[model samples]
Target chain A: MTRRASMAASLVGFGVSVAAIFLLPSVLELFTLINATIYVSMAILALSLALIWGYGGILCFGQAAFFGLGGYTYAVAAINFGDSTWAVVLAMVVPALFAALLGYFMFWGRIGDVYLGVITLTMTLIFFKLFNATAGDAYKIGKAALGGFNGIPSTPPLNLPWDVGSPLAPEDIWYIAASLLVLLYFGSRWLLRTSFGRVVVSIRENERRSELLGYDVRRYKLGIFTIGGAMAGISGILFANCVFVSPTMFSLFYSAQVIIWVTVGGIGTLLGPIIGAIALQMIVAKLGTLEVIDPNVVLGSILLLFVLLVPKGLLPLMQSGFDRLRRPKAPVPVEPAIRPTATPAARRPEPVSAPVGSAPATNTLGGS
Target chain B: MDLAVVVLLQVIAAVASLVLISIGLAVIFGMMRVINLAHGEFIMLGAYAVIYATRWGVNLWVAMLVVAPIVVGLIGVVVERTVIRFLYGRMIDTMLATWGLSLLLIGAATMIFGNVTAGVSAPLGGVTIGEYQTSLYELVIVAIVTAVVLALMAVLRFTQAGLIARATMQNPAMAASLGIDTSKVYAVTFGAGAALSGLAGALISPLSGVVPTMGVAYVAKAFITVISGGAAIITGTLSASTLLGSLNTLATFVATPVIGEVTLLFAAIVLLRILPQGITGKFFRRAL
Candidate 1:
């Protein structure tokens, strides 16, 4: 699709998502409504990872570090200030700052991509250990006790932006969550279209080459990493409002699960991961109810099958099937949009795309 | 003096265990560049193999030494043929796939063995160290690890299999041109790595018992040790395991177990920050 066409389609997606926030609650039960809210929040988390891992080339295994930080930050800030507004802002800013600090060490140190995985993985372990160890009265962060293993059961929910007394019901939270998801989806699309996003992708594809080409690779990496961290923090805020914040938020399970969501969804595509997160979460939830099948078994099988057979993920697989049905021509893989109209369409670095906003998320991703 | 002897013995045991758990992972990673996130699962499988073997009236020694490695090694070969071969060059994808495999193995173990169980108990009585007494099994572990290390060295240094494996890892295309079946080498090497992991798991089973999720604990430590080891597989792994394991053990003695674990991770972070290629990546450039 042309850039104009893609932008128009995005506007439509943006519209439908906004419509769903208010429309879905009317049709769904309260429990389902709450679950949908959780899904949206998780989708936001997935999108944050998609941006960094897919485009920025930084495979952060410790995304949950920011996520848990966001939750803890909001919990502590909310309790101390007796207000949700500043807590929300603090949630985003604190994790972003944390990511910036960590990213500075990583990017400046010339850490290899795999070592980035180890460092980030260690970060999550540290967060988990720190948070889990907070079990006593002495472990108080402001008035809100870290509560250690129990987490902060007293975590205040999000009140109205203008009205402090009106804490959002599950239904109301769903509206905000769904609307935010739509906005982020578009925001990610817009970001990928910009020259800044191109540099990030270029860096992902060939960091040394991009660096030699005069773009400061580390700065681009640090930018996307911080942005991704902030987005993850927002998800944490939403998650806190929905459920009590806990140490499990920074767990290895979550750290690895988020990556599985992206990989199973489609690594390079934003929409793929969002759908993957929501869909996989729903599937796992459903599996939880069944007695015979283990959720991990199902999840593991799906991930294995996806990796072995559909390595690019389910979204790309379906999109290609749709393309084949729509046209007899062989699927022309997504092209780099950096050159816009000047380039005839150089083959994308990876061979995967969704017809909608197929921003240069080339799937043949490897540094060497 | 008696107390000091025990403390030193404890540290050696700790370092030896670290080397055992991480060496297989180092071999696979240092040779093939595959992350093998399922390595922990491989270890768990070995422990389970011991559990089932002993339960089925096999000797405890045979279960830990022979059955675990062979069973898990065969499984490793199958995994390579079916899953890993497709993901040879893609490091991130390989991690994801192996992670999935890890989950699969965990779930499978749960179905077969239930959530947790006491595996085969450690053999032998306590041995006195001056006024202090410690589990003789600790000494046994140290001895077996030493044997494993020497055997690994002999294999890598003296065998044609070792040379071909190294050649294939160094330059697969050139190795292929030289009529070396690099694909078979990859499969065998992966099996060997998995077999080593299995042996480590079996060795530790009597101490820690068996659980499906047990691999989760080992995987991170293995990764930390191997990455800290850097490029040279054997020397790198030995040095890293010694440095990290001693720090971990000494820290445990000084503070809480949680602090000890955290210190290991923290030290790895600092180490990687200073030497991104890992310890061997910077020093010991020539010692394989």
Candidate 2:
């Protein structure tokens, strides 16, 4: 398929999916819509990580820190302003600002990928511990008490843009969440097609080479990392509206789960992580209903299976299978032209080291 | 003077714990360049080994010293064969794989033991210092840590296997050309790292108890110490542990544990910013 043809097809598919989701409330109960809102919010979180880690070659283990910060900021601001509208804006700005600051230090300081993961993770833990420790009355912010480990409960639900007193119903909230997911998904897809996206992807492919070509590697990385944080902040706002914001949002478990969602969805593609998040969340919800078996065991085993057997993830696997089916019947002359262009769209980022199955020639103990 | 002695003891204990948890990571990550995110889970496994052994009527000392390391070391060997061997030199993939491994280990442990915290009490009685009383086990930890570091140093400096392992890590192709089985060296080194982690877990089990998710707490500290320590495995691990550990303990004494932890993390970030290659990466460049 040509680039234009493939793009049009994806756009049509995206539109159908969004429309289906917006109309889902008619088919499902109110309780299910509430649950769906949470799942949509999680999908948004997964998509944010996918953009940064999958496309940018930067792995952020502490994405949840930004997420929790957004939720808490929203909760506190909502309580103070007695309106959810401005609180939502504060939620996005707070996390984006934090990410900008953190990313500047991380990228400008020349922190390696391995150390980046460690640093972000430690930062998340610090946030978790800091919040968990703030249980006293002195921990109050304005009218809202920073309830420490209990988290800020009874957070004001997202209100309409025009009115402070009117809050959306659970069904309406589900539509909003679903619409946000669709918009963000297509927005990221469109961004990836832009020149900046190409530059970031090129940087991910080879940082030193990008630098030699006059690209500011650090600035680009900071930009993407901050954008990822903003997306995560948006997810947090959606989540806070659905379930009360808590310290657990900043926990390592959530951090690890976000990675799993991106990995299992197939990195590098915008759609994979969103699908991975929703699918895994559904499986988890179903598993929770079962009392006999421990869900962690099932989830952990699935993660292991994905990493070991399907390292490229479900999307890549499906893409490759589709490619294989289509390749034989196609003419040989068009194959080479289509192959190169099609790959970047569905391509898994090459492993940072040498290709798998080959012995790496570089000294392992030297600089990372 | 007594209060000073107590603080000194706490500092030593803190440093020892950091060193103990990180030595294994230093070997696996520093030497092999394979980021083992499951290093903490290996420690947790060791603690569980001790807990299970003691329940089966084994002595506490025996459970901690002998059984825990052996079980976890064996598990390490199995992990290397099945998962890690394929991922040699691919740091990020190894990280993801090991993280999955960590989650699996945590889940499996939870299934077997449930979510409740289980523990073995410290066997030694408390010791008084001036107006303060502290666990005698702290002293035991200090002694064990010293012995372990000394033993590691001796083995790495004086043994033929150590030479082969170092050669394999430095240049696997050259080592292979010289007829050394680099894969075997990697397996042994990984197993040894796991054993050390197990030993650390066993030693601390009495103090903090054993839990499936306990690995999360130790993994970050271990990574921070190893990374800050830099490439020279032993010297790097020791120096970084002492620096961070002492700072952490002093901070804890000054304020609260939460503040202490935050201080430690902030210190690590600052240190990384100043010395991105880590402390030993800059200072002890030639030290082993």
Candidate 3:
């Protein structure tokens, strides 16, 4: 399939998913409206990381930093503005701005990929520590007290755009979450179809080659990183509406869990992370209720099994199975060659035979 | 004068701990070019080995000095055989895989030894330095670190096994062509690195205690030290540890531990910005 056709197919698939979500309350009576809303929010968070890591080839170990920042910004802004609409705007803007500044220093400085991981992890720890230490009554922004580790309680939920007095019902919130997910999903697909997305993917393939081709690699990287931060911020806003924002939002565990979701879902696809997040989270929630086995053991085992046995993840596995059924003889291998107009899967078959010592196209390791 | 002496001791102790934690990572990451995100877990395993050994009627010294390294080294060998052997050249994949390994180790440890922090009291007591008293164990750590560095230097510089290990790291294909059994060398080198980490963990257990998640705290600092140290393993690790470690200790003395940590991270950022490849990458080009 051509890139345009594949994208169109994805858009249709996304529409179907959105429709299913809208019709879920009646079809699936077991899931509470509030619980479904929370699941949608988690899926959005997973999609944020999937965009940056899977497509941009930038593995951010501290996505939760931007995520928590968004939540805190929304909560604090809501207390001051006495409205959720403005709070949501601040939530996205603040994290995007922060990401832009951080990405400027990091990308322009030309920090290697390994160090990038370390630096981002440090940033998350810093945020976690900073928030955890704000237990005193003095750490107040406007009227909302930063309750340290205990976290801010009873912050206002999303209200109607014009009437601040009337908050959205759980059902309304679910609809909003589902709608936002569909919009963002299609929006990202559209963005990836643009020329700028091609450049970003090219840079991810080979930074030096892209630079030689006159692309400003750092600028493109910074843009994608900021967009990812904004996406994470949006997820945070949905999260704050679902559950109260806490310091745990910035924890390393959440950051690791996001990585797991993206990896399990398959990194390079739009829909993979959403499926991974919702599916794994439901499994985790189920495991939590079963008191016999420790959830960490199960999670750790799953992660190990996936990394070793099925590194390409569930979506790719399913795709490959489907492709085999369609055409049994010619199994296409995914290669990281520069194929600007080809669909992602179609680009996979060509061996990435770049010059020796040149950057591996699929590798994000950075630096020799 | 006494306060000055105590502060100097603290600085030396800080440097010693940094070196001990990072030397293993330098070997595995710097020499092998395999990013072992599970390096911290190896240290954690070492700490647990010492604790378990002592509980099972071994002497504290024996448990720390002998059992911990041996136990963790064997575990490292098993890990290398099963997981790391397949991921030699793929740096990022190795990182992801090892990170998964780390989580597994942490979970397993938690299962075996609940979620509680365990520890042994610092031995040899405190010694008076004019006005203030400091742990004698701190001085012991400094001495031990000095010995470990010297021993590592001697082995790498003078021994045949060291030459083969170095050869394998520099060019595995060439080393294998020379009938050196490059795979064995890689496995041995990784085990040695893990043993060093285990030793460091056992040595520090009295101060920090043993916890399944304790590796998280040490891993970041070790990565910073090793990365800032650069390509040359010994000189890089030593110089980087001294610079970052002293700065951290001095900052702690001046303010709080939190400020000290923040200062260390800021210092690393500034240092990396100035010298992107690291301290040794620029200066100690010939010193290995």
Candidate 4:
């Protein structure tokens, strides 16, 4: 199915973006607005997996490795530099570099699919173990100390640009986070709309076919993996700004939660992960307050119920339901039939990777 | 010289436990291609089963040998029918669902067992080698692990049931056409895997003690061993466990537990880079 949203979807997305960035703060309570920042940051984490798993077809189980690295990088850099700006940039760069390095081993070595999952999963656990062992004065990286289980609590908050004297208020931080999420939602949608995005998605659908068509599938996979890592890093920076950087960031629980958000939010759509992360985090957080039930039991049950009943997830289910009400004259197969019945022989000759203008498979692959 | 003997025992103990914990996960992944994220929890369930059974007047050996696998095997069957049956071939979904199952198991254990409890101790006493001393249980464990691997290989190689399982895994459609029930095979294989994990848990409880969250310590190591083992499940598990378990024990002996873990991960990265499909993927391709 084409991932591109229709004109109406674009319009609705714009409205949602405006509402989230410009309107939601006024309506939400002070407590919830602060919590919403965490949710927004987590939504980015969910989106990172969505890009990798949903579109790139790479189910990276160690996303939190990059994420925790982002937090720790920011905490360490921020402490050392006495400014959050460079730390924020370093947070994104460090994780991307790490992913690139790790991805180099896996992809260049032809480690794809399920094996990739195990390696990445093990990598995250390794980070958790390594970080947790970093106790005492011996583990400090410059001015910042790796506090082992008790993560760096003294992490500097993001200041107004380079003005380290003035830190952003929680309200201001919320503004930046909420707006950054909106900008990123559009950015992700834009990235998918680009030639690069379609090629990545096509590779996900059929790697061998894409390779036969002359695209270096390994490079595309690595590129997407790196981008996902950087996106996760940004989320880490935002997360550390609110909560202190800790080893728990690299824990399996966070790793699972990001995948859960993407699954629940619905894969193949940016908005789905955002919605899923916020809703589930709110549910689990609310449940955490109640002493009666362990939040994990409820979380696990909900995930189980969702996977069994709605494996396609909430977004696609809702879209189909909406499509049913809107289109009485046709079925779901009509959308895919937009592409020509066969590849035009005249257009099949040269420039195998150009993704030339207006050709169904090559150009605007997901054009709605 | 005694230190060398002690280190050798450590490496053997490490490799044996790695095999014990990972064999079931290897079976499930090898046969069905289903990554049971809750494989570690299945181990936990087995340990708990032993503890409960022993508390209910069953002999410790009976609890460990028979009750653990039976209890967990049945649970695995139930899991397959309810959750896993629908998720065949969907690897990522299976991982997430089983991960959720693990969370439920951990939470349930925490609620029921109150997070901590007294566990059964190893039966044997210490054995000394010159200046160094070690647990005699470690030797027994190594012996038992070897027997378990041998029995598993024998079953898969010699039995009619093993042949049917092999055929079904090779081509479920063909097996079904041949009038064999593939789904039943899948269920049985998954149960067997869980049973093995349960047995591993029971075996390990004496060394590590039983806790709700103990599975977290095992599942990653098991996954690494199984995945690094590659297409050949039995031999792969053996080879990967020996290589990895030795590196881990040797590093821990030289440095610390954390360094040992880092060494294992580093070794896995190098192994996968060198042999992406794993050890069995490159060699012993035909052997089950």
Best by DockQ: 1
Candidate 2 DockQ vs. native: 0.48
Residue A141: error of model 1 in Å? 1.6
Write down the RMSD of candidate 2 (Cα, Å): 5.2
Q: Which whole-number lDDT from 0 to 100 does residue B31 have in model 1? A: 84
lDDT of 3 by residue, A6-64 (tens): 54766688678877877987766445667778888888888888778877878888899
Model 3 stretches with alpha carbons more than 4 Å out: A2-8, A26-33, A329-350, A353-368
How well is each residue in A1-368 modelled by candidate 1, as lDDT tens digits? 44465557667876777677778999999988888888899999999998898777688999999999999999999999888999999999999999999999999998867898999999898889878988999998778899888899988988888578888788878888998988887788778768888788778766778899999888999999999999999999999888889999998998888888887777677888899999999999988897687788888988888877876676666766655575567554453222211001111224343454433432222110
lDDT of 2 by residue, A1-368 (tens): 44465657677887898778867899898888888899999999998898888778788999999999999999999999988888888899999999999999989999867778878988898899999999989999999999999998888888888488798888888888898988888788767667787777777766888999999999998888888999999999999988998899999888988999888887666777888999999998897897666667777777778777776677766755665577666432211111111122223343344433221211110000
Chain A TM-score vs. truth, each candidate: 0.89, 0.89, 0.89, 0.88
- CA shift of B229, model 1, Å: 0.8
The TM-score of candidate 2's chain A against the true chain A comes to: 0.89
lDDT of 4 by residue, B1-288 (tens): 888888998999999988998999999999998889999899999989988998899998889989999999999999999999988877767777898899888888888887785589788899989988899988998998899999989989899999999999889999999999899999999999999999999988887889988998899889999989997889999999999999999999889989998999889978888888899989989988
TM-score of each: 0.93, 0.94, 0.92, 0.93
Candidate 4 clash total? 0
Give the count of colliding residue pairs in each prediction. 2, 0, 3, 0
Candidates sorted on TM-score, descending: 2, 1, 4, 3
DockQ of each: 0.54, 0.48, 0.37, 0.50
**Residue runs of model 1 more than 4 Å from their true location after superposition:** A329-368
Residue-level lDDT tens digits of model 4 in A1-368: 23354656677877877777777778888788888899889998988888887778787889999999999999999999998888889999999999999888888888876788888988998899999999899999998899999999998899977889999888888989878887777787788878799888878766789999999989998999999999999999999988889999999989989888877777666677888998999998988788677787887877887777876578767766666576666544322212211112211122234332222442233422
User: What fnat does each of the candidate structures reach?
Assistant: 0.56, 0.47, 0.27, 0.55
Q: Give candidate 4 misplaced runs (Cα > 4 Å).
A: A1-5, A23-29, A332-368
Candidate 1, chain B, TM-score (2 decimals)? 0.98
